[model samples]
Target: MTITLVQGLLIALLAMITGLDCWLQAFFIFRPIIVCTLTGLILGDLRLGVIAGGLTELAFAGLTPAGGTQPPNTVLCGIMTVVIAATNNTSPATAIGLSLPFAMLMQYILLFYYSSFSLFMSKFDKYAAEGNAQKFKRLNFVPLIIVTLSFGIFAFLSAYAAQAPMHALVNSMPQWLTHGFELAGGILPAVGFAMLLKVMLKPRYFPYLLLGFVIASMISFSNVLPVALIGGVFAAIEYFRTREVSDLKEQIKDIDNGDDQDGI
Candidate 1:
C-alpha cells in the first residue's frame, strides 16, 4: 500500500500520540481507558480502541510505579494491537495474537528507557546543583518526548516496511520456534510481574492485586469497580493511619513548647 506523504504523516502523528500514551501509561500517568479510547478515535475505530485499551488495561492492572519500577509498555501494546487489527485487512483475533509478541518486544524497550532515565536523572541533578533550573526542567521533557515520539514514528513506518521482512522472518521460522516464541511470550510476563511483585508486595497488599486480577477476569463491568474499590479503601486507610501517626508527632512538639513556656 503506497501512502502519500500527508497520509503517512497523519498516521505517524497518530502513532506518536500513542507513543506518548505509552510513556504516560508506564506510570499510569493517564488512565488507560482514556488513552486507548483516544487512539482508537484517531484511528477512526472507537470500538477496537476501547476494546484494545480495556484488555490492555487488564493485562497490566496489577502493576504500578512505587519505588521506581513501572508496568511493561502496555500503551504500545494497545496502540500497535489496535492499529494492526483495525487495518481493513487483519481480524481482531489475529491482531490480539500479534499484540502478545509485540508487547513483549516492547518490554525490552521499556528497560532501555528506564536505564536511560536513571542516567538522565544524574544529569538533571547536576544541572540543579549548578542552579540551572531551566536546563534541568528542559532535560525532563525533551528526552522523554524524543524517546516517546521515536517509538511511535518508528513503529508506524516499520509496520508498513516490516510486513515483507516480518513475513519472511515468520516463514523461515520453524513451526516449533514460532510456537515457542508465542508460548514464551505468555510465560515471560509472569517474570516481570514477579519482579514487580517482589518489590511492591506487602502481605496485606498482595492479595488486592490478586483480587483485581480475579475480578477483572470474572466480571464484564466496564471497569474493575468491586476490586478497585477494595484497593482504594485499603489505600485510604493506609493514608489516614500515616496521617494519624504524623499528627501524634506534631502534638508532642506542641506539648513540649507549652511546657517550656510555663517553665519560662
Candidate 2:
C-alpha cells in the first residue's frame, strides 16, 4: 500500500510501455500479465499482481481489439487493477470488479485522444500523399510519445490518488451498494463485447463460439480456452477457408475460359 515514489514511477513506466504500441500480431498490450506482475514486484506485492492479472484477464478474455472494434480499456486496467488489489488486500472478485469502469474510461480517453491527434494525422496524410516520406516518418513519433506519456502520467497519479478514494468509498458505502458495484463491474462489459460482436462476429460463427464456451466449461478449462483464443482460432480458419474458396472459384473460372476457347 505504501509504495515509494521511485517504485510507483516504475510501475507507471511499465504500464505506459504495455499500453503503448504493444499491438502485437493482433492486440495491444499482450504483455499486461507480465507488466502487471513486474509492477507488483516493484510495489512489493507480486502475488497481488499475479491474482489481479489472472482475474482481469478473464473479465477481458473475450474482449480483443480486432480492427475498429473497441475493447475494454486494458490500458489503465493493467496497472490500476494491480494497485487496488495489492494496496487494499482485495480479492480477485473485488479487484476484477473494480477494473471494468476504469478500462471503459481508458477506451474513450484513447478514442478521443486518437480523434484529436487525427487532426495531425491529416498532416501525416498530406505528407504521405505528397510522398514526403521523411517528414511522414518523423511526424509519426509525436502521437506515439503523447499516448505513451499520457498513460504513464495517468498510472502514476492513479496509483497514489486511487488509494484514498477507493479506501474511503469502501468504508463509507453501504454493504448492498458496494456488492452491487462489484456485480455490475462484472456484468457491464458484456455491453462492450456485444458492441464488438455486432461489429466483427459473423452470425454463422456464433455456434462455434458457443461451442468453445461449452467445451471449456465442460472440461473445466475456463481460463485456458477463453473466448478470445477460440474466436481468434476460428477467425484464422475462416480467413484461410475464405481464401481457399476464392482460389477454387478462380480456378473454375479459368477452366471455363479454356473450354470456351476450345469451343471457338
**For model 1, what is the C-alpha lDDT against the true structure?**
0.62
**Residue 136 C-alpha lDDT in model 1:** 82
Alpha-carbon local distance difference test for all models = 0.62, 0.70
lDDT per residue as tens, model 1, 1-264: 233355446656655666675566554434445555766776667887787666555555555555366555555555555665554334443444466566556667767777777877778779989999889878889866876677666656545544555555545766666566445444544655776778868997777788778878887887547777877888899999999999999888779788656644
Q: Which parts of model 2 are misplaced by more than 4 Å?
A: 22-31, 125-133, 185-196, 200-203, 221-264
Backbone clash total for model 2 is 1
**Model 1, which residues run further than 4 Å from truth?**
1-8, 21-35, 63-71, 88-94, 104-107, 113-145, 164-196, 204-223, 230-264
Provide the TM-score for each candidate, comma-separated: 0.59, 0.76
TM-score of 2: 0.76
